[model samples]
Every structure is written in C-alpha cells, then in structure tokens.
Target: MISILFAVLTALSNGTASVLQRRAAADAPEEDALRLSLLRDLLRKGIWIGGIAMSAVAAVCQAVALATGPIAIVQPIFVIELPFTLLLGGLLFHGSFPRSVWLAVAAVAGGLSLFLLAAAPSGGDASVTTGFWPEALLVTGLFLAALLAVGLRVRGNARAATLGLAAACGYALTAATMKDAMARLDHGVGAFFTGWQLYATAAIGAGSLFVLQNALQAGSLAASQPMLSIGDALISTCYGVTLFSESLRTGWWLVPQLAALALVLAGCIGLSRSPLADGLAPRPDDRPRTDVPAAV
Candidate 1:
C-alpha cells in the first residue's frame, strides 16, 4: 500500500513536469531537436527548469516505490499520468475540459484499476540475477536504436510517437536498473556505490529525459503522451516478470487483463482526440496585457 501511495505521488509529479516541459519544448526551434542545443535552450527557460525539478521529485518517489514493491505493480500505476497531465494542463493554462474528456479520464482510471485487480502482480526478487544484465542491456540498446532511427526519419505526430516510445523504453530500463541498485543498499553503502546498476540508472535516466524532450518538440502532447505512458507500463511489466521474477495471476485472469487493456487503449484514443490535448489556450483574462507599460 505504501508503494502504491508513492507511485501515485510519482505520477503526480511526472504529470506536472510533462506539462511544464511540453510548454517549453513547443517553443523550441525545430532544428534543435535531438541535439544538445535543445537542452541548452531549455535550461534558459524558467518553466523547463521547474519541470526538471518536478522530475527529480518523481524520481525520488519512484525509487522508494520500486524498492518496496514489485515493479509490475509500481510501474503500471504511472498510466494515471496521462489523465493527470491532461487535468493539470487544463488548470495551468486556464482551459476547461468537456464532458467527453471527463468520461475518457474515467475510462483510463477504471481500466487501470481493473487491470491491477485482475493481474495482482506480486513476489519479485529485490535484485536481478547478474547473468541477465548483458542480454537485457543488449536487447534494450538495439530496440532503442531502432526506435531512434525511425523517430529521426519521421515528421510531426509520427516522429513524436516514435520518440515517445523510445523514451518509454529508456525509462523502463532506468527503473529496472534503479531497483537493482537500490537492492545493493541492503548490503552496505560501499556496495550501493560500487554496483554498476547505480551508474547505469543515472545514465539511462538522463538519456530518457533527452528523448522525451525530443518527443515533446516533435508534436503536441496528444501525439506522444499515450505512447509514453502505455509503453512504459507494458515494458516495465515485462522487465518485472523476466528480470525480477514477479508473479501475476494467469489463465483466466488474462481475459480480464486484455479487456482492461482495450479499455485503456480506447480511453487514450478519446483523450488524444480532445481539443485539450493539442495544448490549451489561456483564458482571456489570463493573457498578458501588452497595453501595460514596462516596469523599467
């Protein structure tokens, strides 16, 4: 239960960060995408910095959640971030959502709840076996590379979706490594520091952030958020099962899980089609008054 609570916090923090970062990324020059210059430009924006701060908070919460519970349980909770992002975007941008958006949000929530209830993921080892690392890393690396190649070749929504999925994979790998590193803490401080997984987590997380920025820059949140949220959840579930040996309800339970996934997919499609997903406009009163004199 504590893990679930922390996972929710992680989702909240991540949702807020996504909105802020999306705002900043939308204004960035297209030429800067997938380049270091993108981050350099973002660093100059107060909003982007704020987003990074929130991401740091999310990382802390996620670490605690992963350390305490099965990654399958902790990671899937992040699917709520999609709805949270939409809701937060409305509030921050002074926009209102319609009834359809509300219904879609409900569907996403309900589906996630159903899936978790049906799957009942549990009983994972704290640390992954050493032998699994090389194969996992190699496969993950190739998958990311292929995605990045496709992302670079595409434009608009396609580019955004491709890059978003790539980023999701990177994030899943980061979580897996982070969990492995955290397990080292049980041994000693020296073990935690010496563990290669700690370094791997840091490297992978930073790369994921870079890819996410590119995704935001390529198109509207409507095009990318679903891929990011859903891909991460599914990929992390695989990592939990294969690497950590987590258990889930099987046999007839798969029926409910598939149905729940369809519900979530439908909700995602609905939310993506809503006007709010394209970026909400500020209320008339919230707009800057150009008629006002400068303070200087």
Candidate 2:
C-alpha cells in the first residue's frame, strides 16, 4: 500500500520536475548563433544542468516506486507526469494556458484515477521474479541500445525523430528492468544493491535517462519532449501487460484507461505545439524559486 502511494507520487514528481526544468531550459540565453559552442555551453551550464538534475531525482523516485509495484500498474500511472508538468508549469511559471489544456490534463488525471480504482495494488514479496520474457528483454535492450547509439551518432532530420523514439524505448526498457530487480530483492535496503542484477538494472535505467536529457539539450526541446513522453507510455504499456503481468480489469473500465491514454497523448501534443511552450524555450520560466518573486 505504501509502495503504491510512493509509485504514484513518484510519477507526479517526475512529471512536475520535467515541466519546471523545461521552463528553466526555455530561459537559457544564446547570444550568438555563429559561436554555437560558447552560447550552448552557457545555456547548458545555467539551465540544462539543473533541469537534468531534477530529472535524475525523478528517476530515483521512480526506481523506488518500481520496487513496490509491477511495471504495468506503475508505468502508465507515470503518465501522470505530463499533466503534473502542466500544473507545475502553470503554478510556478505563470504560464498562460488555454482551458482546453487544463481540460486535457484533467481528463488524463481522471482516467488514471478510474484505472487505479479497478486495478489491484501490487503486494508480492521481493523475490526478483521474471516471467517468460527475460531472453526477450535482453535481446530488445541490446537492440535498443545499438539503435540509440547509431541514432545519436548519425545526422539527419529523420534520424532525430528516430533517435527520440529509440531513446524512449530505451527508457521504457530501463523501467521494466528496474521493476524486475526490485521484485527480486528481499524486504529491505540490504537487498537494494546486493545483487548484480539490481546494479545492472540501475545502470541501464540511469544511463538511458541521461541519453534522454542529452536529446532534450541537443535539439528542439518542444519536439523531443512530447514524442518522448508519448513513446514512454506506449512502450511501457506493452512491457507492463506482457512482461510485468499487470492485468487490466475487465470490461466497462477499460474504456477509461484507453481514454486516459488518449488524453495523455492529446495533452502532449497540445503542450508541444503550444505557443506557451515558450516556457520550454531558452527563457526563464516565470515563477519564484524562493525569496525572489519571478512575476513581480
């Protein structure tokens, strides 16, 4: 029960942190295009690093959640990050938003709530269980890693989207593996880093996450973020249902989860294309950090 709560909150925090970091990234300044090196360096130092750090924290929280729940039940719920990002965007950044955006957020949130209401909470003992898919997962992870490496090294517009999607798949893979490791553990922190599998799991998860951050920093924040967010959910959903044994409740309620997914995709689209995504540009997102009032 406590684990479930942690998983849910971790999703929320991860999402919120992304939005906040987006705002920071948007505010970063580039004084010269010709001197791309200096300008890019400055922007990375001032904003990108902070944003990336927050995302790392989110990932750690996510790992904590995976230790408690199955990937299927936990991963989709992580989609909650998108709307929470929006909420954090609005509240912290003074970002001007349309009612439709808020509606989209609400729809996704409501859908997840409905889905959780139907789904049973994960309560299995920590014993590191992998169903029938270990070989498949290993194979897929290697393919994805190769794909991402090639995508990052290559140069083309098509390659950009390809890389984004590949990296997204990689992230999903990491999350799934992390969940597996957590399940394999014995009750406490003692088991946390004791096994080779857990360490490998954490490395893959964290490494892919860094790739995700690099993707964000390397190119269009708007283009990459939405695609990544959507892809994470889809890939994770597939893994969850097949690999994690996260069964969806039958009938009537299925529509709501489906609806929620639609809402999540829609919101990601809306946010990415939004004029307000200027918050995600290289400008300071409007909101206070502590003593200073950003809007004032």
Candidate 3:
C-alpha cells in the first residue's frame, strides 16, 4: 500500500511537472531543434523552475516506490500521468473537462488496476551480475540511437512522437539502472556510488530531459504523450523482467493483460484527441494568420 501510494504521488507530480515545463517551453525563445541552447531561455522562467522542483519530488517518490514494489507495478501506474495532466490543466487553465475525457480517464484508471491485480508480478533480485552490464548497455544504446535518428528527420506530430519514443527509451533505461543502484544500497551507502548503475542513471536521465524538451517543443502534447506513456510502460515491463528477474502471471491471465493493453490504448487515443490536449494550440483570435489565403 505504501508503494502504491508513492507511485500515485509520483504520477501526479510528474504529470504536473510536464504541463508546467511545456507551458514554459512554448514561450521560450526559438532555438535550433534539439539543441542545448533551447534550455537557456527556459532557465529564466519561474514556471519551468517550478516544474523542475516538481520533477525532483517525483524522482524521490519514484525511488521509494521502486524500493518497495516491483517495476511492473510502479511503471504501469505512471500511465495515469496523462489523465492527471488533463485534470490539472483544467484547473490551471480554467478549461472544461468533457464527459468523454472523463470516461477515458476512468478507463485508464480501471485498466491499470485490473492489469496489476491480474498480472501479480513478483520476484526480482536486487543486485545485477557484472556480466550483464555490457549487454544491457549495448542493446539499449543501439535502440536509442536508432530511434533518435528517425526522430530528428521528421517534422510536426511525427517528430514529436518519435522523439517521445526516444525519451521513453532513455527514461526506461534510467529506471532500470536506478533500480539496480537502489539494490546496491543494501550492501552499504558507498556501494550505491561505487556501482556504474548510479552514474549511468544520471547520464541517461539527463539525456531523457533533453529529448523530452525537444519532443514537447516540436508539436502538440497529443502527438508526443501517447507514445511517451505507452512506450515507457512497454519498455519498462521488458526491463523489469530481463534485468530484475520480475515475473508476471502467465497462461489464462494473458487474456486480462491483453484486455488491459487494449483499454489503455483506447484511453490514450481518446485523451490525445481531447480539447484539453490542445491547450497550447493557438486560438484563431489569438494569432492573425498571413499563411492562409484571404477569402474572395
């Protein structure tokens, strides 16, 4: 229960952090795509600073959650962060939350709970074997490099989704490495720092921040968010199983797991189409357009 509570708190903080940062990013000066220069202007924004603070809180909650529960349990719960973002956006922007949006939120919430309960994931070793490090690094690095290449060539929504996938890869790997580092703390406080996992976590986490900023800057949240949520959940599940030796129920329970996936997919799709998703979209009156041809 403690772990579950912390996971929920983490989702809330993360969701809010995402919204705040993206809002600030929208107003920041334009820079070359995917360049470090983009963050320079945002550093001056109070909202962005608040967002970073919230992310710090989320990280603390995430560590506690991973320490107490399986990754399968903690990561899937994060899927709800999108819905939480919508809810917070409504409050912050004084916007309406439609019935369909609420329904999608309910679907996500129910599906996540059902999947976790049915899957009953368990059994993970705290410490990883040294031999696995090279293999893990090689595989994850190749995958991320490929994804990033595809993302950088695209424009608009496609670019957002692709970059978001890259970000998801970075974040999932960070979580896996962080879990291993946490496990090392059992030996002694020094053991945590002595391991390469801690260093790897920081590196990957920083990269994820850059990827996520670029994704948000490239286009609407609608385009990037679904890919971010779903990709993270999928990749994190694989990581939990392969890296930590976590197990999920098999056989007949596969039905519920599949059903849960469907529900999550549907909910994400619906939420992505919601008016709330376009909170950042320019209103017709807000910006005069010279791009569109004048009516006869």
Best by lDDT: 1
User: What lDDT tens digits, residue by residue, belong to model 3 across residues 146-236?
Assistant: 9889987788889889998899888888888888889898999998889888998888898898899888888887788778877887898
**Candidate 1's error at 29, in angstroms?**
0.5
Arrange candidates by TM-score, descending.
Answer: 1, 3, 2
- Model 3 misses residue 49 by how many Å? 0.8
Selected candidate, larger TM-score, 2 vs 3: 3
Mark the regions of model 1 whose C-alpha exceeds 4 Å error after superposition: 280-296
* TM-score (C-alpha, index-matched) for candidate 1: 0.95
List model 2 lDDT by residue over 16-129, tens digit each. 556645554333332321134433553544455665666677677787777766666666676666656655665654567787777766766676666667554343333334
Consecutive 10-residue window with the lowest summed lDDT within model 3: 280-289
Comparing 1 with 3 on lDDT, the higher-scoring candidate is 1
Please, what is the whole-model Cα lDDT of each candidate in the order they appear?
A: 0.92, 0.60, 0.83
RMSD of each: 2.3, 6.2, 5.0
Q: Number of the top candidate by TM-score?
A: 1
* TM-score, one value per model: 0.95, 0.71, 0.93
Shift of residue 149 alpha carbon in model 3, Å: 0.6
What lDDT does model 2 reach? 0.60
The local lDDT score (0 to 100) that residue 168 gets in candidate 2 is 73
Q: Which ten residues in a row have the lowest lDDT in candidate 1?
A: 279-288
